[model samples]
Target: MPFTVQYAVPMTCEDCTKSIKKALDNVEGVENVDFDLEKKLVTIRGESAPSQIVSAMRGIGRDAIVRGSGRPNSAAVCILENAQGKTRGLVRFIEDEEHQIIIDCTVAPTTPQAQQVSIHASGDMSQGAMSTGEKLYTLGMTSKFGDVFSLITRQSLPLMNTIGRSVVVGPPSGPTTESLAGVIARSAGLWENDKVVCSCTGMTLWEERKVATTV
Candidate 1:
């Protein structure tokens, strides 16, 4: 259901309203924001937790209260790992119209090179991504300095298939040879050594869409 959550925020002028609006704008799943200066009420309509909205308000040096009902949506999460299966980051996955998926993660830099993130076959990070063969699909590249990765794909496949799968972020493939090891090596530039995933949204963000709708 489309839900509305109101907050008692501190606002004294247009600038405050603007600041509040800007802060609220970054929150995911937010649909609409309205305010009543007289009551100091900030009404938000969306699907995300009210706590997120409240936290956004606090981010701008304002305090807020959840003046109404708020609930969380369905989500999947994973811990990103390196080729040796060491923890590297966290990944959160959400849906894009049920046919697509958005992977959002705060990753620690695992390599000196730019990293490519992709959905793979195996969920086990121990085998690293070697077990998770095939690109399945590539989300995109993350910078070398541990940046936020927002990879989106309009998947014709099912989300359930991704459940036991893996999201690997690693350096682009290196040189390839005709050797058997090389055959298993890059998998045609789709595989790399520094691949990592953490313990895990895009296209148009869920925050940018109608909150009531879900995949």
Candidate 2:
């Protein structure tokens, strides 16, 4: 099923928009692309993975941050972290109208050997990934490029049931003592998050983005 995703891309001129549009045009699964130059936003209606869309924009020397995706109550996110509390990467789940879930994930500092990713029954983190309960679903294996590992796939998992569960990434054989894990949480849907500044932190979106990138 086709869904909508919004991205904040800085644009300084009409040429920038043209370049972005042209680049996205070549991206498979993209159905439509709309731009808001004044707000520096691009709303894409398609089935393309968000990572792929961002890569396309980067191909043209532009950077894009996902603002929102999917419909209300159809999106979720997880921030993967090691037991030491350092963020390793992020995973996003967007469910389409037909209930198919799109799993988009990126992690780093992984070995060349493929890693197995799965969802656990527990969200407990007192002992890190070890505390999570039995694995409920194996999402898939991730391919490593350099030190980073990325995976984009679709699954039939029910998004609502997965919230508060834990996602673990470990050796292909299964999760080990060194596996990374994170609790799944709800995320903003398309046009659902439009705040320029976070009221809790008083930081602008770009400022928050900078901090996120560094971590």
Candidate 3:
């Protein structure tokens, strides 16, 4: 999905900005990157997934949050840890009674040690919807279908969203042009007249409805 990355990089001079651009520009899947020292922001327009961005930033000892006018799925709990088994931070995706997605990020001393992690968990409850508790169970119980931890996070670590009849169309599997259109539509909440102004990478067709409305 389209996202803006803001980080506290020490870009106090033009040379620093150029250096950042050089590093970020070389990252695979990154399209364009702009750094603003005054705002302490590094805004990036790209299809690169969050994990890729995070990995790149962390490699250079930088931190970033990707948000923007067009975001597709909500990323699930991110457990950043050190070799000492310390949990550096946790970001959770929760849904309330209203079916709206709530995202919470927390800093902790250590990452929770678990048998596994399932990124494809939901927090919202609705008709035919699953609960976060259920997701937790799946993460802990389901091991045959695939490795939940890797499967859910292999892409961009996704958190389950709504679970009702989708207003938009979706493909059976894999990524397609139609799939991208669907995600763009949902994220923007485009109606009959609304159209997708742009498309972002790492977004699924299911998210088109949300983006359509919110953007």
Candidate 4:
């Protein structure tokens, strides 16, 4: 299970988040972390008991208090990997009913060249705009939690649309003989004519196939 911790600290910069993350990273059994500066919230994952987490946070010189017992909704985590099963990067989609989902980028343990990300959707994205139809809005790496939260509340895009929109993820290396074959296997030629859209470098055919299947 996941949990959240709220703290009352003077964290005026990213450096503060980084410092807290570094401190938490030193604790054993921690798995993942997501910190928001404006909300002053930190979500952490671990297999250990909650008491241990509370103690660890206290050791970091912050007044930490448990805030929630579960992972936040509409948060989708994409784990990118290379041919040898090495991690590459993370692409997270945070959705809300008021605005388009925001995407966040983070480096994974392994980076691949020529990597592609496929997005599968069931509903039409054309209702918003021509480009908006196929292009799902995702927060850029530089996105801040406060900014994204504001956008979500202002626009009113249903969070459920993300699950229904036809998965349009890609950046598959053009229509090469081998890459085409992989797409055929996964998308059944639905994306045969679509252009590769990902910006990852050095991604291999196997990785592309894997991404196609996953998306």
Candidate 5:
């Protein structure tokens, strides 16, 4: 899985340029390299570790660092299905870095109530129903067909871990009997929720936005 990364480096001569070029070329996962003299920027397209790229530049005695990234270089998606017509969801995994992945999730809300959605070990919803496989991550959806929720996992794991897996949307089994209690339960620290999820992500819920979109 390769993505693009740009870097800033200080080079005064051809020797400096060549040295930096050669250094980055030798990196284990770097696929291609192009240097812009005017911008002093280097764009690399590969699976090279960001740290490794910076280290390579430093090895040439040139102080270099990353420039800009607008999106993930690599990605994967899951097609979520629900039988009760409660909601449908789509979860995307965006590249955070070489070692980590960011979750970009969208769901179509059918029921006004919040549902517990997540990435599971398998996509088969028929066997034991929605809760069939091991629940990998708990997801939150406030509005159905609109805004996307962003969650960052600390694992820095590869997307290969999700290739054949499925995303499930269902009711949350919570300790407290309340609306969206499953979500609150997750925040309260139950199940395997904290291991993969690092923190609370900025996302929109129906209640917050209904004020603006309401008739």
Candidate 6:
């Protein structure tokens, strides 16, 4: 199913937009692309993976940050981190209008082997994955590609119920203290987030992006 995903791109001229459109045209599964030059936002309607879209944008020497996806109140995100607070991966959940949940996950520096990914009952992360409660739902296993473990699958999990839970990635046996875990949080829907500056930090989008990428 086709869903909308929005990105914040730095564009200074119509030529930049043309470049982006031209690059995205080669990405499979992309249905359409729309741009807001003044806002430097690009909204894409497609079935393409978010990572693929970002890579496409980067192919033209432009960086893209995903601003929103899916529909209002139907999307959520989790940043899996180890006990040391080092980010290990990111997971995005999008429930389409048909109620089919799209799970997109990416983990780096993982062994070139399959590993279990699931949601736990508790969101507590004081002790990392070990502290998260019982496993509630097993999304699936991730397949390794190069140095990253990536998985893009469609399931039937409800988005709302997963909020406040914890998603964990670990060995096939089960989660451990060394496993990666993160609390699920609600994310903005397509076009729901349009602020150029973060009110809390008074930092521009690019500034925030700098901090995020550094981390």
TM-score to true structure, per model: 0.47, 0.80, 0.40, 0.29, 0.39, 0.73
Better of 1 and 6 by TM-score: 6
Candidates 3 and 4 compared by TM-score, better number:
3
Q: What is the C-alpha RMSD of each candidate to the true structure, in Å?
A: 14.0, 3.1, 15.1, 15.9, 15.4, 3.9
Indicate the residue-level lDDT of 28 in model 2: 96
TM-score of candidate 6 to 2 decimals: 0.73
Clashing pairs in 2: none
- lDDT of each prediction vs. the true structure? 0.48, 0.78, 0.33, 0.37, 0.48, 0.79
* RMSD in Å for model 6: 3.9
lDDT string for model 3 (1-215, tens) is 44333333444678777767766766877887766676455656565554566456646654443332223343233332322333333333322222233332222212122223232233222211222223322222111211111111122222253321111111222212221110101121101112212255544221322232221
Better of 2 and 4 by lDDT: 2
Off by over 4 Å in 1: 1-20, 23-31, 34-73, 96-99, 144-157, 174-215
lDDT of 3: 0.33
- Candidate 2 ranges beyond 4 A from true positions: 47-52, 63-67, 110-114, 144-147, 195-215
Candidate 4 lDDT for residue 104: 29
Candidate 6 lDDT (Cα, whole model)? 0.79
The total number of steric clashes, by the backbone 3 Å criterion, in model 3 comes to 21
lDDT of 6 by residue, 117-167 (tens): 999999999999998989988988887543467666667888899999999
Residue 124's lDDT within candidate 1 is 45
lDDT of 2 by residue, 83-150 (tens): 78878777878776567777776776545566888999999988888898899999888875333676
Regarding lDDT, does 3 or 5 come out ahead?
Answer: 5
Off by over 4 Å in 6: 47-52, 85-90, 102-117, 137-155, 202-215
Model 4 lDDT per residue over 1-215, tens place: 33232222335589878878887777777788776676566666554443455445556655443333232354444443333334333333443222334332333212133223334332333321112234344321121221111011112234444544432222342211111110101111111211222356555322442333341
For residue 210, what is the lDDT in candidate 3? 26
